[model samples]
Target chain A: MIHEYLIQLLTIISIYAIAVTSLNLTMGFTGLINLGHMVFFGIGAYASALLTLNGVPWYFAMLIAGILASVLGIAIAAITARLKGDYLAMVTLGLVFIAIAVSRNWISLTRGALGLPGVPDIIRNNFYYMVLCMSIAGICIFIFYKLINSQTGRVFQAIRDDETAAAVLGKNTYFYKIISMAVSTFFAAIAGSLLVHHINFIDPTIFDLEFLVVIVTILVAGGLASIKGSVISVFALLALSEAMRFVLVSPALIGPVREMMFEVILILILLFKPKGIFGKVDV
Target chain B: MLSLNNICKSFGGVKAVDRCSFKTEENEITSLIGPNGAGKTTIFNIISGLTNPDSGTIRLLNKDITGMPAYKIAQSGISRTFQLTKVFRNVTVKDNLLIAKNTSEAEMKKMLESVYLHKPLDAIASELSYGQQRLLEIARALLKPHALLMLDEPTAGVNPRVRQELKLILKNLKKQGKTILLIEHDMDFVMDISDKVIVMNEGKVLREGKPKDIVKDKKVLEAYLGK
Candidate 1:
């Protein structure tokens, strides 16, 4: 029983690692304040779930879901190209509301509050599934690491530092912004697919503001603009939350207490270490 | 190599640049000098495509470039430095130059040397002093491919020694056949380096002539110290 629980916990961590690291690409590395990142995850989960339910294979469904999310990400980046700082944050946050309304009201496609259940699993065994999740997560991180060191990554940081300066230097800032958003959302959606397949069910509520808060907390505590920071923080924070499960006497208090702990930790990190544990770049 | 034909820009009710027009000779330093609020920086912005003119045409190498996007203008062979330095504060010196245009390590080192910026290539730009940051900005501008170079008050806030170094660098760039346009308030620096000088006041050109001749003009004197 302990073995199974550990495997499940590792699986959850691996999936979230993909989501937060991808988000770090835009929010941290590129300096885009994307508050609606969870919408991409939601889109991926729903797209993968819908496709797989209609006799499509899991791998193909997941890939398509990621692409769909990327396309939508490009759209959002283009729409918000002129906005920056808090204005950009507000517009992206509005995206979450629009996504929720569509998912909840469009009953025929999403089944409304009654989420699509029984998401097919590619790997039936718990241990093997955990390994697969870990492998994919590792590959994603490796790609991100390689990208962060490339010329494109440098351009992203340049744009983040000062858009006017970047443009004066002859960089097409708008085009690069779209590229950052596309890559970020693509991986985020894949993480969503992994999550739905792991739990074998996904609802609109699963990818709500609460989920965004958790992902953001992990990114912040890990540090912005540092891939190593994200990876390390994800493991540490997820492990901390899981450890709380064993210490808490009542299962009912686990959820509330875990949330309280995250808030306290976030507050302390902001007050003492605003840059985060491994933040290499200033926000 | 570059000419402005009756360029004008207005911010709300105030005319920042009013029918301003001048031409720069190829491979020469042309200085635009004016008292405060004479629209010198506004003219620079209009030429660089950072701000659109109320009505005017800018021609570079005899090609019409009015109203083009700033990046496109830059790609078309115009490079510039801001009135206030705009170096990428978070990144290394090398990364800052690379962002302008990827060049060889030897080339970047040489460019840094030309600006008299002796810091290591790996140094974060923000860590540099204000004068050093300004030097870095100039290096980045020079590293980018360009036929025309524009400096907006290049020595506005630098020490005299750095200013002397900048004077040498601009003179060297001129020897290499690069057309240069600059806005400077330092009278001595302006007279020393400028091949030609254009004076402005109340959004209009007060005088345009050789640096020696501009200093003796009564209108130019009156514009500097109002009648």
Candidate 2:
């Protein structure tokens, strides 16, 4: 039982690594604030879950899911291209709300928050190792790394530093923003799918404010714009959350205490070393 | 070829710019000289599309293009440097060159060397001496090899040697057929290098002529240079 749980924990960590790493690509390199990151994750999870549940082959379902999620990312980016700084953050926040709302209302397709279940493990027959392998090797993980180290990545950073200067040099910043947003969203979808299979369920609540808070914490604590920082943040925070439950040893360990704990930690860090563990840009 | 016609601009009851009209030909260094509040920089903003004139037409290559966004205007072949040289402070100089974002490594090196900064490519832009920073601004403007370039007070706070170097580069840019528009307070430097000189007073052109003629014009002497 311990071995199974350990495998499950590693698998979860791997999925978070991919998702947060992709987030780092935008937040770190492009200086984009994407509060609606979970929407992309949910989109990818559902696209694959629904298609395969209807008898589509696993690989094809995943492919379709990735494409759909990436396209959704592009759409959000294009819509928010003109917005900058705080306005951009607000726009993404609205996206999260709207996505959850759609998931709640679209019962015929998303089952209207009754929740999607029985999503087959990405490679089910092989059990723990199978799921673990899928989670680690998912397109999201592979592509996130690839995209960040490219020439495109450098341009994104340049734009982040001084967008006006970048624009004058012939960079179509609007188009590039869309491209970066799409790529980040595609990975979010992959992470979502991993969650769906592990729990054998999906619901609008999976992308709630609390979930967003966790993601933001991971992104911040790990470091903004640093892939390495984000990955470490995911592992550290997930372990902290999961281990804290067992350590309680008293109650089911419910409630608002986590937020308070995080709040205190956030304040302490901001007062002391606010740049995050590995942030090279502004804190 | 850069030209402005009937350009009038007002800001909150103050006429920062009023009834301005001017023309600049290709491959020539043209300087706009005026008193501090006489609207020299404001005119630069209008011509560079940083601000739209309340009423006027801006033409580049003889095509009317008024009220275009600053970056778009830049991409359409007019590049500008700020009065306060805006460098990417956080990045290294090489990275600064890299941030131009579309240059070949060859072109970047060529540009840096043109401003004699190729050797210190690893230095941070902000860490450079005041003169070096000024030169970097020009090199940055030259990085695009832009058809029409505007520089606001390029020598205002620069050291003498650095100022001389900048004048040399502007002369070379003109020789290379890149039209250069500049706002300068140094009459000697402006007159020495300019193929054409424009004298402005109270947001209007006082006279436009050859350097000698502009200096000799009676009104030009009284309104500017204290001659």
Candidate 3:
């Protein structure tokens, strides 16, 4: 039983590592405060689930889901290209509510809050599924590492540091910002597809504020603009949350207690180390 | 190579730049000098496309560039530095230059040395002193290909030694055939290096003449020191 639980926990961590790392590309590296990141994940999950249910192959469904999320990401970036700091944050936060409403109200397509359960598994065996998740996560991390070190990545950092200055240096800030959003959402959607396949279920709850908060917590603790920090923080936080399960002894209290723990850690990190562990750039 | 014809800009009810007109000679440094709020920086913003003119046209190489996006203007051969040093503080010195233009490592090092910034490429910008950061910003600006270089108060906060070095660097850039436009409060630096001086008062060109003649102009002296 313990072995099965460990495998499940590791799989979930790997999936979230992909999500957080992608979010870091926009939020940490590009200096976009994207509060509605989970909306892209939810979109990917629903797209994959519906496609697979309608007889599409699992891998193709996942790819299509990522593409769809990327399109939405580009649209959002173009619309909010002129906004910055708090205004941008508030606008992106609104996206979460909009996505949740759509998923809940679009009964004909999404089946409303009833959700699409029984999502097909990519691999029947739990151990093999975990391996698949880990492999995809590794690939995503490697890609992100290469991207953040490239010339284009330097432009992202420049825009983050000072948009006006970047523009004066002949960089098209709008184009780079949109590209960052597109790449970030693509990976986030892929993670969402992996998540739905692993658990064989997905719903409007995927767009929950709780989930967004959890992702933000991981990115903050990991440090902005740091992919390695995101990966490490995902593992550390998920392991700590799972370890708390043994101490709490009450399934009812686990959810709120876990959230509280995250809140405390976020507060402590902000208060003590505002840049986060391994954060090379300021938010 | 750059000319502004009757340029005007206003904020709310205030006319920040009103009927401002000037032209920069090719391969020479032209200084824009005036008292505080004389609309000097506003002219820079309008010319650089950071602000659209309420009226008039900006021409670079006789091409109408009025109201173009800042990046497009920059791509059209204008590189600029802000009055306040705007270095990418969190990144290394090398990354800052790379963002401007992806040049070779040796070229970037050479550019840095030209501006007397002797720091390691990997050193974070925020770790550098104020003067070093200014030098880094200048180096980043120079690293990009451009026909015109606009600098706003390049020696505002630097030590005297660095200020002297900046003078040498500006003179060297002039010798290299780069057209330079500058907004400066340091009269000595302006008078020493400027091939011509354009003085403004109340958002209009008060006087324009050679540095030697600008000092003797009655209107220019009144603009700087009230009657």
Ranking by lDDT: 3, 1, 2
The whole-model lDDT of each prediction reads: 0.90, 0.76, 0.92
Model 3 clash pairs?
none
List candidate 2 stretches off by more than 4 Å.
Answer: A125-149, A254-261, B8-19, B52-55, B62-72, B101-110, B116-135, B156-178, B200-203, B216-227
What is the fnat score of candidate 2? 0.25
Which residue pairs clash in candidate 2? A28-A225, A41-A188, A107-A112
Best of the candidates, TM-score: 3
Interface RMSD of 2: 2.6
- Model 1 lDDT per residue over A1-283, tens place: 4488889989999999999999999999889999999999989999999999898999999999999999999999999999998999999999999999999989999999899999899789989989999999999999999997888999998888888888887888999999999999999999999989888888789657878878988999999999999999999998999888999999999998888877888888888888899996765
| Candidate 2, A1-283: lDDT as tens digits | 4466677777778777877777877777788888788778878888888987998886787668878989878887887887888898899889888888898998999998797888886655435644664556455556666765565765687678777666665567777788888778776776777677667788888767877777777877877767778877877888877776676666645345565556666666567767688876665
Q: Model 3, range B83-196, lDDT digits (tens) per residue?
A: 999999989999999998888999999999999899999999999998899999999999888999999999898899888888889989888878899998989879998899
DockQ, in order, for the candidates? 0.78, 0.38, 0.88
Compute fnat per model: 0.69, 0.25, 0.85
True contacts kept of 1: 0.69
Per-residue lDDT of B23 in model 2: 93
Deviating ranges (above 4 Å) for candidate 1: none
The TM-scores that each candidate's chain B achieves against the reference are 0.97, 0.92, 0.97
